[model samples]
Target: MANYRLVSFKTCPWVQRAAIVLREKKIPFEFQHIEPDNRPDWFRAISPHNKVPVLRIDDRISLFESASIAEYLDETHAPRLHPEDPVERAINRAWIEYMPTFVDLTSGHAYVDSEAEFEKAVAAVPGAFAKLETAIEARKGGPFFNGARYSLVDAAYAPFLQRHLFLERIRKIGQIDRFPRVKAWAVALSERPSTHSFPPAEFEAMYRASVKKRNKWISQFVTEKAAAE
Candidate 1:
């Protein structure tokens, strides 16, 4: 087994991607959560890209980018989180690559600069999810992106799904209402142990305060945040 240390920010969805993979694979790893503004000098020196989700392996090598880290964990560990067949693996990789789009669509409502911008952002999302709903209708099974087996694709989507669920609670955008498969996937991912595992007690409060600080749309549309489910 390799020694693993992950450097991360508390609320980064990207970092959560790697964390989910690590936990799902049952890798014994150390995780350091740093506030963005308070990142350590040593961490900065070692992380060439200066980003969160840097996975330090054996104190000798540091892997930056959440995608790279997740792939490394999946490749090196047992209980593979990806499909075995080459074509299926390629398909899953394509879906995993789409995670960032999910982030942008799901996160815009809370951080857009103006009401019009917020409306535009949220407007683009339903069409995007409609596409996903179509894709997901073809999924063979349930409770995860890959059905019965939890894969890297599920880990990739889980964090953003949680974010959207949070948004649903705050300001009922009904983002997933029209898409039953997408809604069911989101609900299942939200319940996974890895999804709810990280984040400090102050995560929700801090996230809201930060967004409300920067975006009036958040404050106007958001009510008191419910506790994490």
Candidate 2:
């Protein structure tokens, strides 16, 4: 058995995708909490890009973009997360690539900019949701992305699916109900023991608090600028 450690942050979709793969594979590993802004020096040493979701497999350190990580884990682990068939695996990989584009269009990279930017992002949701609706319907036989069993594609996407559901609660984006297949898939994925195992409430609370603080700072900045004028 290889000694394993995963350096990650809760709110990062990339990190969450990797975590989902690890869980599905039933791989035993240590989770090291690293905040995005305050990443530890050791993490920087291991990952030249200073990204979260860096995995240490004994002495070999691996830094992967989420899709690559899922594929690598699926290939290495006991309970496989990918199909053995070449054509099926290609289809799975295609969906995995498709997810990031949907996530980008729907969630708008987590509204990381001005309110004007956020509004523009929110406006893009409907079209993005439409694409997802089509994709989900295409895979309607699925409890997982590839049909019966969960695959690397599902693991790669689970985090974004969760965020899309959560965003519906916080923002008036497109309704998940409009995408019935996706809605069911997200609910089922969320209920998985591994999916539920992470500390969502705690992370959400922290994120909400951070948003409030940032909003307050912006407000104060505006007031100060007006006063100066």
Candidate 3:
């Protein structure tokens, strides 16, 4: 195995995806955590994009971007995470690439400034889930996106799905309840050893604390609602 070092920020969804793929592949890697606000000169020197999820394969080759890191990991390691057939593999890759939309849709609900906004965001959430419901419904018997065989699509979405834990408690949204298949899928992915890897226990606590100061509107809204309930 080539020397591997992954630059990540705990709880960064994009970085979590890369970390999940590394763990799932059973590839030993050095996990280097860096704060985005205070990146060192050496890190910025290597990363033109200045983002987490930069995987250092060696001194000569450093890769940034989650998808590229994942694809590289899948290609280089054994027990391939992507599908074998060309079309099916492409389909899986399409969903893997589509993960950002999942983050966007969930954010609309998770970080609202007011009750009206929360309601509006919550109302819109089903529409998002409805689309995923269609896709997941098509593939029955799945505790995973790819059924028995866990794939890169699962890794891509696991971070997004893991947010359900925080959203359910903080937002009081019955999002997972609305979509049975997706709910089951999230639970399965989260339970997988690799899904729980990377970010430590305090990561979520730290996230909530940071966001509270960052967005007081959301902090007030969620706090009031949480108190009422």
* Best model per TM-score: 1
Question: lDDT at 37 for candidate 1?
Answer: 85
| Candidate 1 per-residue lDDT over residues 1-229, each given as its tens digit | 7798888887788888898998998889888888788889998988888788899889999899888988988888988999999998998899888777767776777776677887888897887788677667676647676678999988998878877877776677776888888899888887788775545335555555655656566666554556333
lDDT of each: 0.79, 0.68, 0.77
Predicted structure with the largest lDDT when compared to the true one: 1
Query: For candidate 3, what is the lDDT?
Result: 0.77
Model 3 misplacement above 4 A: 198-200, 221-229
Report the lDDT tens digits of candidate 3 across residue range 175-198: 668788888888888778898653
The collision pairs in model 2 are none
- How displaced is residue 55 in candidate 1, in Å? 0.9
Between candidates 1 and 2, name the one with more favorable lDDT: 1
Residue 6 local lDDT, model 2: 77
- Off-target runs (Cα >4 Å) in candidate 2 are 109-119, 210-229
Which ranking of candidates, highest lDDT first? 1, 3, 2
